[model samples]
Target: MTIATLFAAVVRAKPITGFIVEDDPDRPQLARSIGLLHLTMMGVGATIGTGIFVALTTAVPEAGPAVTLSFVIAGITAALTALCYAELASAVPVAGSSYSYAYATLGELPAFLIGACLLLEYGVSCSAIAVGWGQYLNELLAITTGWHIPDALARPPGNGGVVNLPAILLIGMCLILLLRGAKESATANTVLVFAKLAVLALFVGIAIAHFSAANFHPFAPKGMVGIGTAASSIFFSYIGIDAVSTAGEEVENPRRNLPLAIILSLLIVTAAYILVSIAAIGAQPWTAFAGQEAGLAVILHNLTGAAWPAVLLALGAMASIFSVTLVVLYGQTRILYAMSRDGLLPKLFQRVDGRRGVPRQNSYIVAAGVALLAAVFPLDVLVNLTSMGTLIAFAAVSIGVILLRRSRPDLPRGYRVPLFPILPIVSAGFCAYLIVGLPADTYALFAVWIAAACVIYFGYSIHRSALA
Candidate 1:
């Protein structure tokens, strides 16, 4: 109970030998089925969903016409952490992403804490992404049928509706695809990612065609504070970039492909986000971005003064949300599977289908939990929560990079973080800065979640951990 004892207890880490060396005969194995292209699509699938599709409506109002700069700021933060992610993911090549990396570097207790953060990140993010699907689906329906879903069924109760049925249904579809197996899920994600990207390209093309210089006047109306706040807010859109690491066990030539996918996906999404932000701001006044549902589709509808283009964008948004949710849900299940294999949770989480090679029970549990959140919470509530969890996990990854470099310098790595300690330290600093900028309520909720996780860890995980 003394300080020295407590410090030592928390720092008791696992050996940095193998990510797949579990002695548990019953532990499920993941097939090495994902390649560079599919893994990059997984990253794109996990990101580029609701952020550009829906988060813009919220972020643009904060930074005014300067929102594109907000994308740059957030992208830099994400890229820093991603570089750290790439290094750890390459060397570790495990299912838990940051959690596994933390275990390898920061010890069992810290790893459990990071694992808790990821549980919150992936679970809430999957739901948050799905919640916007209803809005876009309604948009598509309204344009084609002259009618849309009633608010009670389309929006969450927090948004002045009873439940979000479309979001639940979207989660249901993802559940089916995930249970089929990893390769099938990744294949579908690749197709969906391309479809959504093309749709975004169409959006940017239209926005530029109608670009007005008037909208760019008085850029940064709210100045530095506003831009920083908006960057912190929109960073939620970039949450799933680490998802590439979650597929470590399933990636082919993981040391090479894992880092490659992580970096490639970040570059691709960062460019897409920045381009779309500029185009949207150019096409319309930043003041007009607030409180719009299916905002991209709405922008097209207003710009072109037609319904067909909006409907087309709405269809794309649906595809984006579905792909994002599917991949995030997949990430969540893999995380639980990893934790369970390490004896952090119940064995049920690690149980897999003998034929399909996925943690079947884990998928069903994660889908049901995400569906409930999507059905009940408003998009705004879940968005900040997801960001909060991801920020902490990101900071952990950066710190993990530093810790592992000192502890295991001889370890073979497929990728080395450019500039070494400087980048990782800066990455952690950026994540901390954004964490400080989040709303007070977000901090309070995150504290409560962490407290709950500590309780579970002390009461259950610490006693059952494989390293114990």
Candidate 2:
């Protein structure tokens, strides 16, 4: 068949309506045992890791004390995009997230592209979190024993290290848990989420005691351009807020819970981030924060003149990174499950391990790929790529909300974005602005990624799609 014919068939076969149908015949049935609290915790689990642990150090020096302002900017962007996501989650209430949203409103081609972007967004983000986890693990070890894993083993080769063994190991452990089942993964995630919060709270409290106004003297040292750039980087931290929306099909009373989880989680994370940024800046000059690895641990060591606080922060980082990996990995598997069910990918990915009620084969494939990337790739590059994909997906969702309003006015939307076209339009514009602010290298990478995705869809996805 011609490429156009194949694409059209795929689009027709799995029309957006397929997502709204109550039961999907080809997909495995997931238990709706997760409640609002669990979902909220999941958001916390996914979001609290890299932004606070690693990105803050990178951001503080760039924006100085104005890094707090960057957090607000990132939060606003996340909140706006989340509002659009809330409506879509409630409207579709499916597992595929933006992929499902695109399927419902745009068409199969757009849905395929969204799915491809999400693959990079979720899978690579997991790797990035694992790398961050390794840094913390090394800090914890050094604090406890006065020794660390060799620098070569602790970092990726490109970063002047022989290998990132800890990152790969962490990803492996999370993979096993994910293969076990969703409920188990969620429970584990909930515990880690609380641990991360507790440690961060402790950091905030202790760091406050060392507060020095001198650090705030040159607040915006890098100026407005620096603030904007840092905001773009910190924006990656908010990527996980949408994990709530991905759980829509499994959420109880999605209409209420989906929006609640997304908004409430955003608020909680943003508040914690702002407080942490303020505390960190207050504790030391912004220049000291530059290029500082294991930032929280360093702060603790400086504050108490003891290794205990650093140890605790390190332990927390380990748990935080673990939880982040689990949730992001879970998201990647489910999105692939959705695609496979729609016949856009190998049917093997749709196979649910009946005992675990999870997509076992898909988990293995994703785990292998993510683990490889975690071991060999530089963390910064992976993070920026993830941010780029997410920004595009967020922008698409915002536009989708506006398009759906006009095209399917009669459809019952559980939650509507406030102010309709205006809200979604603003949300789209904000995401686009962030995208533009990304470095030229990021744009180059994104272009290549999208081009590869389009090629894959035309060559394989279109012809094999269930709709075709």
Candidate 3:
């Protein structure tokens, strides 16, 4: 068949309603066991990492105390897109998240592209966070003792070091947990989430003692451009807010809980981010945050004049990064599984391990690839690329909400976006503005990635797609 014919067939494929998966229907049964609390914890597990712990340190120095305002900007952008996600997620109530929503509303080609963009967003972000964890762990160890891991073991090449052994090891550990099953992985995530939160609370509490109003004197020192730039970069920290939407198919009372989880998670996380940023800035001069690793640890050391708090923050960061890796990796595998079930990719990706009720092979494949990237690549490059991919996907989902509302008004939606066209329009505009704010090279790289994805869709995905 011609490519156009294949694309049309893929687009016309019947929507698979409910949790039934024909090829591996057993997977849905495996998934249904996950409940609302576990799903919310998954959001907590993923949302609390890198952004608050690391990104704040990086962004605050650039935006100054107004980094608090950047957090607000980023939160608003995420909240708007998240609302659109809630409506689509509730209406579709499917396994794939945005990919599924795009397929149901846009077309198969769009779905494939969305899936590809998500690969960059989730998979690459996992790698980035893992690398960030490595840096903090090394710093934590060095602080406790005068000695540190050799550059060869803890740092990537060309940064005056070799492979990041700790990062690779962390990714591998998360992979094993994920292969065992989602419930087991979620349990571990819950524990880590609480530990991380407790440590952050300690930081906030202690830092308050050192807070000086003097820090507020030059709050907007960087001006509007600085705040906007930092907000765009820090936007990566808010990426996990959509973790709730991804679990829509598995969520109980998704119509109620999905919207609740999305909004609640965003609110809690945003509040935490703003509080943490303010605390960190207030405790130390904003200029000191620049180029700092394990920044929370450094702040603790400066505040208490003791090593204990820094050590605690480092330990918390280690656990937080591991949880982030597991959740994001899990998300990537599930998205791929959804695409495979749709026949947009090879069926091998959709296969589930009957005993574990997980997509074992796919999980392994994703983990291996991400681990390598984490071990070898520089994190700064990976994070910016992740932000680019995420911006495009977020923009698409926001626009997808509008298109669906127009085309499928009769479709049952559990949660409607508060303001139909206006909210979605604003969401899309916000995402677009963030996308434009990224460095020129990031935009070029994103273009190349999307173009490559289109080529794959036409050359392979379109022809092999189940619908075709």
Candidate 4:
């Protein structure tokens, strides 16, 4: 093909009007049972899990007592993206999440690319959450029964151990719960969110009792570079702030409820994360954070010289991480199901069980993929992969908000971002900066994933797409 022809083919945009018009009669319809309350709980459920509970072991060592500042930086970046997400979710109100927004605003190629990135955001996140669950589950067992899973079976292969059985089992259990249906899943998630918040509140209440000023002496021991690096790593904790947007189709009165839930969920999650970080650092010196598998539980055990408090924290981690895995896994399946219906993926993914009103086959496929990664890979590798995918998706959504405003000025929007182009510009810029902060090896892996996605699209999906 000539250069002109190739460039024209690649940059051509999908029609805004046609893409937004629903046409497929056989397309699976999700039950629209979620309210503002359920949506808010889901966002909280997805956000508060493994990221805070398991990530500190690495983040604290990087920034010392300044880890609190790292949380602030990450929260700002996430808030920017959340604003963009809210505006788009209110306008689009669809099932495919950001992928659907990109199709309506950007084009087919961009939508396909963003869909590829979401595989990492949700799939790898489930793996990371499951790994954390394994660590906390073992800790809880040891504290109460004086016995734990053998290290050889508890840790992943990359951690110099055999397959992580507990992580695999955790994914399997979530898969079963998901197959039961969405309403049941949402109810379970709501309960889990409250239980998680209560446990963290308990931890803060107890830890502050033993707060020490000595831990704050050299707060930024590693300097600004360390804080930036820690903030980039800590960004993983905020991944689920967009979970509310993913359920736009199911959310009641989506226009108003979607944006409200997104904003409210962010505020609640940010406060919880900041309070936990402060209490943790105050309770114990930051230098001792490194290499501790279950950092929070270890801190409580060391502080009180008692097993009960640590066991309580461990129980909370297990419940919280399990909920995270369930919600993230659900997000992955729904995104793929949307793609399948659009003829961009195999149709098998689009099939939903008529009676159960759930995508049963899709759940099984996601479960197997998530369980394999959780069973073999180390936590750090899964975490960086998840963060990279989310940062890219966030940048795309910010850009989409700008494009849609220009292309469809006549469209009605229930929620408009406060500072039109500036918020999106800053959101996209910070997302790019965080992506750059990731290790070179991670960038290489991301490049490979994108290239693979391109090959798949050009070889099969492009010709088969419903748009074609």
Q: Local distance difference test, per candidate?
A: 0.90, 0.84, 0.80, 0.86
Best by lDDT: 1
**lDDT tens digits by residue: candidate 4, 1-468:** 577855554455656555356545575577778888888888889999876799999999999999899899888999999999988888888777888888777778788899999888888888988989989998998889989999789989878679999999999988889998887888899898999898899889889999998998799999988898888887877877656777766678988998889889999999999999999999999988898888888888988999988988999988899888888888888899878877899988988887777889999999999999999999888888888989988999999999989988777788888898999999999998888778877788889999999999888887778776
Q: How many residue pairs clash (N, CA or C atoms closer than 3 angstroms) in each of the candidate models, in the order given? A: 0, 2, 0, 0
What is the per-residue lDDT of model 3 for residues 106-149, given as tens digits with 9 covering 90 to 100?
Answer: 77877788888889899889888988888788878888887888
Ten-residue region with minimum lDDT total, candidate 4: 16-25
TM-score attained by model 3: 0.94
* Cα lDDT tens digits for candidate 1, 145-247: 9899999999998797999999999999999999999999999999999999999999999999999888999998989888999888888788667788999
Order the candidates by TM-score, highest first.
1, 4, 2, 3
The model with the greatest TM-score is 1
Q: Model 4 off-target regions past 4 Å?
A: 1-9, 12-20, 23-27
Under the 3 Å rule for N, CA and C atoms, how many clashes does model 4 have? 0
Comparing 2 and 4 on lDDT, the stronger one: 4
Candidate 3 Cα lDDT to native: 0.80
lDDT of 3 at 179: 87
Candidate 3: residue pairs that collide: none
lDDT of 2 by residue, 1-468 (tens): 777876566565244576766475665576676788888888888898999998877788778889999999888899999899988887778788888888877788888888888988998888888888888888888888878999899998788788799988998899889877777888999999999999999999999999999989887988988888888877888877767777766778877788778888888899999999999999988889887889988998988999888888989888988888888888888899888878888898878886778888889999989988888888878878888888888988998898777777877767888997888989988888777767889889888988998898888887777665
Q: Where does candidate 1 stray beyond 4 Å?
A: 1-7, 18-20, 23-27
**Segments in model 2 whose C-alpha atoms lie over 4 Å from true places:** 1-16, 22-27
